[model samples]
Target: MTKPKALLIDVTKCIGCMACYYACKEANKLPETEKVEEDLSATNYTVVKETDGVFYRKLCMHCNEPTCASVCPVKAFEKTPEGPVIYHDKKCIGCRYCIQACPFDVPAYEWKSNKPLVKKCTMCAQRQKEGKITACAEACPTGATYFGDREELLAEARKRIQENPGQYINHIYGEKEVGGTSVLIISSIPFEKFGFRADLIEKPLSDLTWEIMSKIPNYVVVSGVFLYGIYWIINRRMELSEYNKSKNRDSSEDKN
Candidate 1:
């Protein structure tokens, strides 16, 4: 039930179309960005970037073990069972910890607002609840961004990889990055050429961090007891020395 909803993006199929970007803007009813070409603003949850004849649909990765949820002190962000990381604006305290913690740098603050919620892709949770698809998925003419269960998407990715190894890099970009992502990417060229990040740890960032944190409480209790024992022993030694001195003084008085 902890499993989050995810989107599967096949960049090889994507044309440098801004339909998805415009769809997201219209759906969210966000303010326009300063750029006349494209609105890439805090309110804009989606953006398109083109380079060297390659195009990518960039937005929140929606990590499986979201760092935003873990680091948020006020519990503003939540990971839904369906697979999207949803931010509760009312709960947000304007703290930027989530922005810093996310490896994908997905959370965008509304600098224009006095109280801004961290914003990112919600995987169209509302649309899914209503039996509809996301704005981007609906708007995509080439079907680059597919909307469905994560398992089905991954299977489709594997099928593509097996069917044509030469055509694809043979890796699902989000299959298991940062503990697995709801949004998966498959590209024709090396992912790096598509502006994909090359360096990612084998384990999700949380697994490595949680493993150490899980041991901390036990260590603290054990260390506290050990220190307490040392203090008791030192006090006992002082008491014993003082008792011996009293007895020696009594003997000297008797001899006198």
Candidate 2:
């Protein structure tokens, strides 16, 4: 199997130029809004933000075990072997389950579309298929966002932190959070400064959901059997009562 790809974002190197944002819009063929949006939305797949003088980019994490994929009733979201968590708009049911299930709150709905679908970054899967880098990564002038094999990116992230101990926070976000994502980050300051969820557990959210859902079938079967048993007992009692009333009338007639 081909190794999964990933992106490593070095927040210390980002300049908040918004090149990635525009590149994403062009790649996805999204029209420019009247005003530039600083947040992730249906039209904006990726965005760069500056928080307290630190710049960080936000987009889909493309998790190894995506909760969005698991929660999608129609299987609209897919985590590909190529490392992109892709969306099949044709399969979407507009249930918005993926939007609610995503821990990062990444997915957005196309409220303006007559036929809406969930929207988020696909890690430029189309471009990757054509052997091209992601539009956002390609447009990054400062090399703040670099794309490569996921394993290689992890090694590089660790190496950078080791080489310059004073320059980084020594933690690589996305390396283990939510069971490891394809997008990783190394920041000088805590990721919480960039509005990242630091409290996320290391296990995949999907696993937790699966653990609960696995027992559902058993629960349903047990409840169904119990209900059927109650119905049978009630019906039998009615039948016996009707038979007893018929025998009493027959005895009264025989006595007369």
Candidate 3:
């Protein structure tokens, strides 16, 4: 099996150049606007944000067990073995379940389009298949975003932290959050300072979703039987009322 690829982002190296952002728009053939976008949206797959003179990139996490894939009833979202979470437009029912279910709030709906679909980063799955790096990683001039095997990148991240104890925080973002993600980050500052969710559980969100989904069949069976019982009782009462009415009419006729 092909090893899963991942992106290792070093926050200290990022200069907020927005090269990756522009490359993503160009690679995806998204519309060009007059101003640079600072937030994720249907049109913008990636964004660069600055806080206290520090730069960081925001995009889809491409989780190993994606909550979007788990919550999508129509199987619109797929977590590929190649370390990308891809969306199928044709399979999407526009239920917006994925948007609500995603813990990272990465998925965006095309509200302006008449035929809208959920949009997010695919982690350049096609490029990986072609043995090419992601567009964002390619465009990164500062080497802030490095792409390679997930395990190897993880080791490299640990090595960086170990070599420079005072330069980086002890924690590695995305290493265990939501059961690990393809995108990893190491930073001098805490992740929560960059608006990253620090309180996320290490457990995969999909596990909880499956737990609820497993009980659905039993709930449906019980509900069906209960509704049928009510219907039967109502029908029996109607039949008895009609029989009583007929008997009274016959008795009145005999008395006359």
Candidate 4:
């Protein structure tokens, strides 16, 4: 569908001011955590993560086959045709399974009260539907973040890496991870050094887990093995019992 996507984040310009976070909360009209300045709530869709000298803007990865969508028991999370993975709070049962299943750790739990909702970036779905840029992109002062088609973004990322080998970390974080995410990341320091979870696999995070438990003939294999073992044990016991009975009969006969 030539669906619109986003550029890989270049962390070079992010100064960790968190103007984007404030813009997001204001745009969404979300309440503050009030305990610390960084209290992420059900409404705070996008936030920032920082490490020694690098900063990351954490939000939904908008994965190709999102694990959150796949794991939602009632399907509260949905991937839009336009490429944004959006959440429907009304259908949500307040179950946080999506939080646990997400490898990127984007979704945040709203544990403050009853009727709390799990929240993460929607890729600014409402604005996109209305033909506008994402709030964070628009609010960014450094022109650091951008939005576009996923394919085009990856190409741009590659081009940048090729043009300036020493400038970037030479890795595009989300281009192929999780079956190709709509949101991409380009970093300055290595992503792991910047507090990104590097342990997540490149596959759709749910695929392997779902496969071993849901598909193939593992159950049949296990059942066959169990039955075979039981049968072997029973047969051995029967043979031993018969031998002992025969010995007793032979002894009695001999005695008589």
Candidate 5:
């Protein structure tokens, strides 16, 4: 099996350069923007933001067990063994369930298109298959974004925090959030300061989603039966009312 890959982002090393953002746009062939986008969108899969002079990148977390994959009724979202959460456009029903289910709010819908599809960073799955690093990591001149094996990246993150105690916060974001993700981050400032969610549970959200999804078939069956029973009762009552009316008219004719 291919060892899962990951990206380790050191927030301190980021230089507020939008190299990763531009490289992603070019690699994905998205439309070029004159100004850097402030948030993720259908066209902009990734964005870099500066908060209080600290630069940080925002993109898909690519959870090991993706909630997007679990909530997609058509199975449009897939968590590949290579560490990418890939979306299949053809399989997508445009239900936008993945958008609602994603905890990170990474998935973006092409709301302007007549035939819209959800979009997000793929973690450069094709580049990984070709034994090349992701476009973002490759374009990072400061080495702010480093890509490698998931386990190795985690070790590296811990080492950085240990060696430079004053430079890092000693917590690796994405390490245990939603059951660990392919992308990790270490920073001097707390992640909450960067708008990263601090309330995320360590358990995989897909596990909870499955618990509900497993009962969906039974729910549908029961609901169908209930609705049919109501229909049958209404139809039977209408038929009996017509029959009684006809019988009364016949009795009136015989008396006359």
Candidate 6:
């Protein structure tokens, strides 16, 4: 089997350049506005933010077991074997379930469109199929964002941390958080300082959702039986009332 691919982002190496941002916009065919929004939006698949002299890049993490894929009733989001969590817009029902289910809050809705679709990074699946890297990674001049096999990238990140202990924090963000993401980050400072959520557990978010969903069949069965009993009781009462009324009417007619 082919090894899954991944992206390793070293926050210390980033220069706060918007090359990856613009490259994402151009690659996704999004319109270039006069002014760029500093936050992630439908048009902006990736954004670079600088806080306290440290630059942090934000985009879809693409979990190994994606909660977005789990919560999507229409199965619009799919985690492909090749490594990308791809979205099929045609199958989407505009429910926004995936947006709510994501741990990183990555997916954004198109508020401007009459029929909006959830938008986020695809890890350049099409480009990968063509033996090319992601546009963002390709446009990165400083090589902050490195793309390769997931395991290989993990090894590289560990080596960098081990070799230069003073340069980066001991932990590799996204290494095990939410069951390991396709995108990994190694930062010099604490991740929480850069607006990254550090409260997430190591287990996959989808597991919790599946535990709840597993009870759905039981819920349906109990509800169905309860509703049927109510209907039956009402019908029986109505039939008894009609029979009593008919008997009274016959007695009156016979007396007349």
Q: What's the TM-score of every candidate structure?
A: 0.91, 0.88, 0.85, 0.78, 0.84, 0.85
> What is the model-wide C-alpha lDDT for candidate 2?
0.93
**How much is the lDDT of residue 178 in candidate 6?**
92
Clash-forming residue pairs, model 1: 4-82, 4-83, 5-82, 5-83
Off by over 4 Å in 1: 1-4, 34-41
Q: Write down the lDDT of every candidate, Cα atoms only.
A: 0.81, 0.93, 0.93, 0.80, 0.93, 0.92
Residue 49 alpha-carbon offset, candidate 1, angstroms: 1.0
RMSD of each: 2.2, 2.6, 3.8, 4.4, 4.8, 4.4
For residues 1-256, what per-residue lDDT tens digits would candidate 4 score against the true structure? 5565774677877888787888787777777666434434466777677776777777778898899999999999998888889998889997789988788877887787677888888888898889887888888888667778777888988998889889888789987787778878887788887556777777887787788868548788898999999999999999999999999999999999
Q: Write the per-residue lDDT of candidate 2 for residues 197-227, one digit (tens) a residue.
A: 9999999988887889999999999999999
At residue 101, candidate 4 shows an lDDT of 79
In candidate 6, residue 67 scores what lDDT? 85
Residue 256 accuracy (lDDT) in model 4: 97
Ranking by TM-score: 1, 2, 3, 6, 5, 4
Model 3: residue 101 alpha-carbon error in angstroms? 1.7
Candidate that would win on TM-score: 1
What does the lDDT come to for candidate 6? 0.92
State the TM-score for model 4. 0.78
Return whichever of 4 and 5 wins on TM-score. 5
Steric clash pairs (candidate 6): none
lDDT of 6 at 52: 85
State which candidate, 2 or 5, has the greater TM-score.
2
Query: Which stretches of model 4 miss by more than 4 angstroms?
Result: 32-36, 213-256
